[model samples]
Target: MRRSVLGLLALLASTALQAATSVRYCDYPVYPPVSWSDGKQPRGLAPTVVRELFGRLGYRVEMVVLGNWQRCLLDAAEGRVDVVLAYTSAQREQTLRFSKVPVLREEVAVFANRQHPLAFNRLEDLARYRGGLLFGESYGPAFDQFVAQHQNIEWVSSSGQNFGKLIRGRIDFVIQERRTGQLFVEHLPGAGDIVALPPALSVDYLRVAVSRRSPLSAHMAEIDAQLQQMADAGELERWLQESEVTYRDMVRQP
Candidate 1:
């Protein structure tokens, strides 16, 4: 009877070990290709990659589609979520534990009115122009230095709104992701007026971050290692491509 009871207890322990680890993840829902939900469900390249990587690591991932970029950062900062993916910037690194593997790179570029394009290979060239930047977003150390030293630049609330204001000639040029601005403009009424430039401010690497308050701090290195493995195998890009195709199909469906 004692041996039988021990065997049953061991079986229960094994079963418990097999159960998925629950992880809550948050992301900006408006940013497409990176993260955006269909209102009813979460679906995007960033979320897809997060889901796949964690799933393989034995975690049951749940995606939270937070309203705005700033709020999503806040949620992660407050430890209201276990992890936040596709995050970048040294400013953010000061507050959160970050992934060593960069999920992707975003080219920070300037968009201007087609008639008066802002031409420059370097950031210093734009010092003479009045630049419009999103209020809560950080472009990195160099851009931050430029913004601080240049009185010509002004910060605004929304990237979409900034693009609109730029179209109306309210601001000289707006800074944001090259692909993001393109995707956003494609869906906007004033898309015809905006033009993204050839020169990018920087290629910011996107990474998954864990909150300092999260219980998963011990596993961050493990997560980073797994992500690096995925990167080495080109699994991350392959997953992104697959998710892009899926997102396109989902959007195309009537």
Candidate 2:
């Protein structure tokens, strides 16, 4: 009888452990100052903010740093990863669920070597020039939709490669995010001529994408609400500012 009682208690404990809430997230390792690991741990602007928000919500979060942008999207699409960083474009909206609160504002723009001027007042203006774009990545509706219509744009495997090609004069222009372009420039070896276009294509809101099959779906709305509240109270900006200061301090030190 004692054995039976002990067995039941053990079973209850196991069940409780199984019932503990967990969220699995995925993101590419390349995007620095946003989601990179920085050799020690996941240290970046997005990771810092996200870690704080989810930690406060009492959710056990685990991050899966994937191979590249494409794999991250696939993991989220296949429901293997419970959540992913960044927003869903119109094409991906059909497959994934997005949080209502935006985490960051993404500005996609055209970049060219400063030595050469690539006229880009609007999307239609790019018809004349050969362009390079990140493989398996989208520039929201306007640019992606435009690419679908115009087959002349070359699709490259990585943003670094695209920028490199632009510097080599292999492509007339490349469209990418301003922040991402800055990071790429900082890391790109032997940077020659590269400058961002004065005009931006579109400023899209970036949000956390949730997997529909994950048990965490039920709580995503709550998380989104908390994020919105933080944004309204200027807490998100404050966190970002603090993160920047921390990054600068760390960079300045040994």
Candidate 3:
């Protein structure tokens, strides 16, 4: 009787050890190609890479659209979620730990009406033209301050809306990420005349970040190593290309 009780307790402990650990992740629902939730799971480069990386590290990972971008950040900060794949900002650094290796690079570019392009040689040159920017978007501190002080730029609620306003000549230019702007121009009817100006306004990175309060924060170096291997193997670029096609298909679907 004593032996049977000991064996039963050992079996229960073994069963607990065999259980897989699960990780919850969140991302922006509308930022295509890099990461966007499909109203179900996250789809795009960063999400896919992070999922693969963490899964291989023996964690059961699921990326979901918990809410909007702001909500996702809040959740990651407050420990409601274990992981969030996004860009790093000084404000976010207080509560979130970021991987040393970025999952991808994002190029912020200027899109202008081809019929009335602005001769943009330097930052101050933008002051000569009227422009539109997405509401709540940030282009780093210096650029933001310049926009506030020197430029006559209007704000719109959505990136697509900014492009639409540009079409009607309401704004002379639109500031956007280069690839994302390409997708918008391709998908938005009457945006055919929109062209991304050369020499991107700025280059930023997309990284996989974990909440400081989460246990995964201990695996930061391992995550960075995996991301560097992915970069070396060309997996990240392949995923980016695939995401573009996937997103275009999603846009075309009725």
TM-score of each: 0.80, 0.81, 0.78
Q: How badly does each model clash, as a count of residue pairs? A: 0, 0, 0
Over the stretch 80-106, how does candidate 2's per-residue lDDT look in tens digits?
987777757876776678888888787
lDDT of 1: 0.75
Query: Residue 48 in model 3: shift from native, Å?
Result: 1.0
Model 2 residue 66 CA deviation (Å) reads 1.3
TM-score of 1: 0.80
Q: Give candidate 1 regions above 4 Å deviation.
A: 1-20, 86-88, 151-158, 246-254
All candidates: CA RMSD in angstroms? 5.6, 7.2, 6.8
Q: Is candidate 1 or candidate 2 better by lDDT?
A: 1
Q: Is candidate 1 or candidate 2 better by TM-score?
A: 2
* Tens digit per residue, CA lDDT, model 3, 1-254: 99999899867644443354888887665567776656667788877887788776667887656435667788889998989876677777888999888887889898999877789866788988898875546667768788889758887656667888888888888888898888868878898899998877888887888999887786676678778888899988999999999998988998
Better by TM-score, candidate 3 or 1 = 1
- Better by lDDT, candidate 3 or 1: 3
How well is each residue in 148-232 modelled by candidate 1, as lDDT tens digits? 8887777665666788788888778888778767776765666697888887778887788888777765567668777888889
Candidate 2 Cα errors over 4 Å, as ranges: 1-19, 242-254
What order do candidates take by TM-score, descending? 2, 1, 3
In model 3, the worst 10-residue window by lDDT is: 11-20
Error of 2 at 232 (Å): 3.5
Kindly report which residue stretches of model 3 are placed more than 4 angstroms away from their true locations once superposed: 1-20, 37-40, 128-136, 147-157, 252-254
